[model samples]
Every structure is written in structure tokens, then in C-alpha cells.
Target: MTVRPLNSVFIGGRQIGANCLRVLVDMDAPPQLVIPDPDDVGVDSWFESLVKVAKELSLPTLRGARVKDESAIKKIRALKPDIIFCIGSMQLIPKEVLAIPPLGVVNIHPALLPKYRGRYSTAHAIFNGEKETGATLHFMDERIDSGPIIMQEAFPIGNEDTARVVYDKFTEVGTALFKRFVESLKRGEEIASTPQDESKATYYPKGLPSGGKMDPSWDEVTKKRFVLAMTFPPFPMPDID
Candidate 1:
């Protein structure tokens, strides 16, 4: 069946990247940027970059507390559109925020969940030596990256792949999958969602910059594993301390 397009909210930092831009164009939706104020933790260029992407797409941008801003909530309510397309929205969207656009508050996550859940999924996957890794499109909940899964696709991890490369690949795959999900929703089709196994769900905190840096003082095997786990470009491993 042919799927209809939608009007969506693009919430994320790193909107300038190719993966995200392509998804924005394909959705063919009017977007709004939702970013945290500068005072918020984890607020940075990524958020600003996303707003820029929205502007390029001729979408509105909103910067305020995700939960406390009455104006922002009202603005979203007024839009009353089909779906919310959220990418790197670093903050945990509150339950109040989720209720605003319940049906359409969807997110593109960077890792296969029930496994790696956090801001650093790509790095975690590489460190774990998982044979396959991919992305997921799911409903946003009060919890972080822990909603019912709408869709996921996995790709083999190459021996030479780095955290940066994995991130790039996942973002590309995720955006495409999300576009399809939006289309399905617009057509009144039920997008499939799978409940993740809680026991299998593993959470990893943001690691040191050199996540897999080997200590010159460590054993050979430990060093090798570190080398393999942290070999990705653009993301340097911290020096062994």
C-alpha cells in the first residue's frame, strides 16, 4: 500500500550531519526544533546544529525546558499534527511532554536496545565486540530509550570500524527506518512495536573519552581487546591512567 507523508517535529542536535538531513528531506514534513536552554547540562552545538537543520527545512525551533515550559507545550499542542520526529534530543522528555503528542512522539535511537541504553551506545557496542549492531525507532517514554520498539535493523560490525563510523552508519539506517515508520503512521497503519526484554536490557554510562584505551602496564590480551574495542576514528580513546 502507498504510504502518506506527515508533519513532524525534528528534535535533535547534530542535524547538520548527512544522515539526519536526508531523513528530514525525505519526510517532507514541517519541523520544529526542540532544544534545551544553554544552562542545561549536555546542551551544546549539537542542539544548535539541529535547529539549523530545521531552519533549512523551514521548520520552527523551540528552546526551553522540555517539561516546565508552558509556552512550548502550548505551541506543540497548537500544532496538533500527525507525528513528532525526534533524533538526538539529549534530555529525557518528561511524561508531560510525552502526553502532548502521544501518537507521534517517536525517536531514532543509535543502538539495538535491551543491550546498550544511553548516550554512548555506539561506543559500548564496539567495546563489547558484538558481531552485529544497529538502530531502533521507538515511542518516547518518560524513561530514557526504554519504550516499546517500533522498528530495528542490525548490520555487521567491521573489524576496522570505530565508534564514529558506527555512529554514522546507525544514524543513516535509523533515519531511513524512521521515515518509513512515519509513512506507515500517516496512512493509518499500525507500526509494529516489540517490548524489549528487561533482563536483556543493559545500560552503559558515558565512558572516558578514550573508552577503550589500553594501559601500557596491562597484559597483552587486555591491551588487544582495548585496541579492538576503541579503534574508531574521530573518537580517541583516553590515555591509560
Candidate 2:
């Protein structure tokens, strides 16, 4: 359904991209709210950064539990928002929670849909030596990252770039793309969501921590791949062998 000047609630963490920020910035549009609580993980810079962004954008945000919390839901529903934007939210939203906002919810995935549809898309992308990767704005479904896609745009992965660089790069691109979508929504425009081609879609499970260590006796190409593959900071690489 086409919506106009929606009251949007931002369900996101520290790693939220620019697109989510834009939605927060629209002139008195949907009052933006943030849920910064982290679940099963230590403090993350992404959450801290999100708070800063909200302040800078002058967007209204409320912080509460990371996952399904009745209190948070009650507050959000009280606002009677039109739509919800989930950005790098660490927890899976419950179906009941998803139903609260009538206009539906949209999530920003770091990887292109149908492929890299789960956690660690960046690592998988680099491990596979993908030359290009982009962001996917899709409907949030019962399955993880398996929703119908609303919009997607690819950015070239530099040969010298590591997963961390790629992650940071996509934030800029993804956020911009997200802003465009918010504008369209405000104008009551409907975006077409292309169902993913399941045949070609691939999902990668969480990689073993030890598996990321650089292999000894590896050739130059393999060594470089090792570096790129384990570029994300949390997944560290072994010292150059």
C-alpha cells in the first residue's frame, strides 16, 4: 500500500547507514526512535554511533531492551506509527512486534538479497572474492533476511579493500539509497520488491573462528585472499606467515 508522510520508527543499532539517518531527518516526518540495547554481545561502537547520529539529526529516539520487550512495543504502538525501519538490529523481531506498525517494516541488509541472506554477508562476500556487493532494502519476514526486496544497489569491492573497508563503504552508499526510498514513501510512491531467485541464492553459516586464521605455506594469491577474507576486526587474521 502506498503511504504518505509516514510516522516511521527506526529499529536499529550503531551500524545504521545513512539511509536510515535520512529517514530520521525528514522535516518532522515520522518521529525516529532507536532501540540501542545489545543482546548476547558486548558494547558495540555501532550503538554508540547511532545515538550520536540521532542527536545530530535532531530526531527523537527512545532506547530500551535489545529484543522483544513489551514496554518498548507499547511505547512504539502508542505513537501509532505508519512504518518501521530496522537497521542492523541485532535481534529478530517477533511477528507480534512486526504487526504493531500497520504500514509494515523494512530492513536494511548489508549484502544483496537472494545471496548472502544471513549473518556475516561481508565475510562471505570477501571469502568468495566477489568483485561487487551492495545493500538490499527488503521486507522483514519470518526467516532471516529472506524477505521480498524493495531496492538494491551494488558497489565495487576494491582489490585492496578488506571486509572492514567494505563494511564502512556500504554504510555511506546504503544510507543514501535508503534516503531516496523514504522520500518516495513520503510522496505515496510504491516500490516494487523483486522476489529473490532462490535457485541462485546462497546462505552462509557463521564461519568457525579458527577457520579464519591464515594458512601456512599459502601462495601470494591465497595469502592476499586470507587478508581480505578476514578483514573484519572481530574476525582477526593470523600474523603474516
Candidate 3:
């Protein structure tokens, strides 16, 4: 079996990021260089701790998380990876770095593109009473979650489901797409990607809607989904008036 001659690099932290790295290694693609979540390195982050163990167990990794920082950008540019897979990156990757890779950057988002685009995607889905939400794997560009679609899979949302449940389901589907996407490239299969329609696009900002506010007049179903989506114990409830 002939594998594609592609040198991939990973820029992400935590679940989706870690999962992508695992796929890269399992496929025997190459000895990848991982730039862990910047906040994880010096903090008490389990994500960082797991990365450290991977390195100690001999997983080739480099430390980087901020794409906007000059020094970190410089280090990444020097590596010249063919493709950069980003997941769970807090900082938006600048165009300067995006142009450095041969295949460019691709990110996995929890919501289907051109519909729910932004940080609180899953929550927005629940709050707005969306019946169906899915995952999207797309090529990254200058805009936020406004990238061409590489692969997408949709899953139904239970009327009584919470945000984490939506997240867990999407993560399962998205990770599978990630695996198939990489393998398709290795096998030289054509990836049919399509441009997103901006007219149908809707953008939601990070954090709470109406700037940390919620409507008390909403029905029980709406309120239930909102609370479930936004509030998890050990984490404080969202500030509402």
C-alpha cells in the first residue's frame, strides 16, 4: 500500500486536537510535531500533562499554541508542514501562517458551516430549538468557521438533549470524518469540497447572547435546553438577569 507523501503538522489542544494527533500517528503518516495548547504547558492542565507523557513516551512534539504571536509564528513557519490540522485553538490563525503550508489549514467545527458559525454554536443550536445539528470538516480561511467544506455528517438532536450531549455526538462523528479524511488523502481519493453560501450564513458571538443575558419569558423546553447547554456543575451558571 502506497501512502501519500504528505508531512502533516497539528496545532490544537484537548479532545479534538488530541484525537487528530492520534489518527496521524496510527496511520503511520510520519513522525508528527505537535504544538500543544499554550495554556497547557505551564499550567495544571490535564491536556498539557497528557501531552508531556506522549513526549516522554517518545511522541515528537513542539510547544506552541498562539498563532498570532510573532515568535510562535516564526517557529511554525520554519517547520514547513504540508498540512496543518487545527482543533480547539483559541487564537485565530493569521493569514501569514496559513500560506506557509502546502495544503493549507483545516479545522473541525461542531456545527455545520454557513448556519451556526462561532464559539457558542452548540448552545445556540439548543437555545434556538434546532432539531438537527452536525459536524463539519473544512479548509480554513481568513473568516471564522467560514471555510470550504471538505466533509460533513449530520446527526439528530434529541428534544431533551443537553449541550454536552450534542457535543459528544458531534465529536464522535467529527473524529470519524477526520480519520476518513486523512486516509482518503493517503489513498489519493478526491475530496469534493464546496464553497459556503454567505447569504444563508448566521453568526453568533462567543459567550452569552445579548451580552450575558437570558429571557426569563421563554418556555420550559427552551429554558431547559439553555440551562443544560450553558450550565455544568463545578462551573458556575451563566450570569442572567
Tens digits of per-residue lDDT for model 1, 1-241: 6656565555555532324545656656445444433243432332235544445566555744563467766776777646665666555565666776646477778888867887678766776667688988888877778889989999888876776777778867876786676566657686678888899998877763244455578676555545656655555656656
lDDT of each: 0.64, 0.72, 0.76
Ranked candidates, highest TM-score first: 3, 2, 1
Quote the lDDT for 51 in model 2: 57
Candidate 3 TM-score versus the reference: 0.89
Off by over 4 Å in 1: 1-5, 15-18, 21-24, 32-48, 63-68, 208-221, 228-236
Which is superior by lDDT, 1 or 3? 3
**In candidate 1, what residue range of length 10 has the lowest lDDT sum?**
38-47
lDDT of 3 by residue, 1-241 (tens): 7678768767776566666666777787743566666666634342434365446547666664467778867877787887888876666889988898878798988898889999878878887888898999999999999989998999988877777778778878888999999998888766678999999998887865434466789777766777767753345777655
The prediction achieving the highest TM-score against the true structure is: 3
- Cα TM-score per model: 0.80, 0.84, 0.89
Ranking by lDDT: 3, 2, 1
Model 3: ten consecutive residues of lowest lDDT: 42-51
Q: Comparing candidate 2 with candidate 3, which one achieves the higher lDDT?
A: 3
Strongest candidate by lDDT: 3
